[model samples]
Target: MPVGSITRGTTNTNRLRRVDRWIAEQPALRHAADPFVVDLGFGASAVTTFELAARLIRSRPDVEVLGLEIDPARVRTAREQLDRTRAGDGHFPAGLPVTFGLGGFEVPTPDARRPAVIRAFNVLRQYDEAQVDEAWRRMSARLAPGGLVVEGTCDELGRVSSWVGVTAEGPRTFTISLRRSGLERPSIVAERLPKALIHRNVPGERIHELLATLDRAWRVHAPMSVYGGSQRWIAAVATLRHEGWPVIGGPRRSRLGELTLPWDAVAPV
Candidate 1:
């Protein structure tokens, strides 16, 4: 049995697109010899796992994706869905490099081959904050050298999301992604911070400072919104970089309403 509880299983097609797109861009998956990826706690539907495999295959043809869920019933349903797809009764590509399994933060694999990347979105939101470190440790231990653990949360529509990228060395970077249109403020994403940093968003916290700074920058650039949300977002992110936030990526990523910072900048406390 897996070492976690069953979640609400609330998922939709492309509900994880932002994180999946980011994962496909990562060197951890793109450069692995035979990249094995895990979708930990992959809800009731295996569609996200299927989509993950589809996106990654474009970067690494040999990439394999396994959707692991703590709920046996969910695993069985996903297997059945895969079966339907295999039998030409479903929409997914037949025989894609995907599988469904039962596992949790421990990340059990049939052949015991460590995976190159494990995506655990929305999995830890149900646990107490203190359990996050142990869960990260367990998952990171199952990673192959140079592997990555992307853990975070996203809205039901997948339009807004945030995640932390952890390696064996510990958390490395934090990212915020949102749909460009109707973005009220960059700080709106603070609500979706990963379990490790959610509660720490109070006074005197690095994450809080980061969000406050971003809000200030957004206000300073509000006039640019007349042109477009993307323009305003790029301006705000550029301002953040100028003000020494160690923002990662550049105009291209920022134009997509995404910003990344070194994890040390906001690692709890």
Candidate 2:
């Protein structure tokens, strides 16, 4: 049986753009022989799943995307939406390489083909924090070689977001993404941390310290905001890297309001 409960079913067309862009850049998806991606628990609508396929195909033209929902009713709803799109009433190219299935953390794909990348945004937040590891294990076990599980959450409208990159070996990195322009402070992303580190954002925890340091850097670089939010964000991230925070990515990514660090740097206590 599928392994999760129904989520709030809340989602929008571009609600997952941040993560989708990040996933498209990953070597796992770009280099796979037959890239297959899964949008796990893609809530209410298959819009994000279709969006994911559209974005990924730019890197791997033959890429296939599957939208998996544990709820049979949701699976049905998504299929109906797919039908509409195929009928030319929607924006998607007719017969886009996307499908909907009934499954959960188990990630049951038709023909049992392991996916090259599984994007599980906003799914695990519904589970108890303690269940994250097991869920990760289950999903990772279904990954194709060099595959990844990109799990995270984003606020409504896709502005502030965070996700952890997990592989069959283990969790690799944590990334925080903001909208840049209206971003108040880096710490605002704390609310969207992936399930593994959300509760660990309390004082004394590594994740907490990481956010605190970023917030401090943001404030210190407030003057740079006069130039632009991107400059301010770049300066703040540069500060974190200078202070030996293991910040990953360069100006190109930083200018986009994204900061990534090895998972070890912010793993839960």
lDDT of 1 by residue, 1-269 (tens): 67877888888999999998899889999888769999999898888999999999898988999899999999999999999988888767897988988888889997898999999999898899989989999999999999999999999899989999999989999999999788777777878889888888888999999999998989999999899999999999999898889999889888877899999999876
Clashing pairs in 1: none
The CA root-mean-square deviation of candidate 2, after full C-alpha superposition on the true structure, stands at 0.9
Q: Please tell me which predicted candidate would have the highest TM-score against the true structure.
A: 2
Error of 2 at 256 (Å): 1.1
Each candidate's clash count? 0, 0
Give the per-residue lDDT of model 2 (tens digit) for 86-193. Answer: 898888898789999899888998899999999999988878898999989999999999999999999999999999999999899999999878778889988888
Rate residue 25 of model 1 by lDDT.
Answer: 89
Best by lDDT: 2
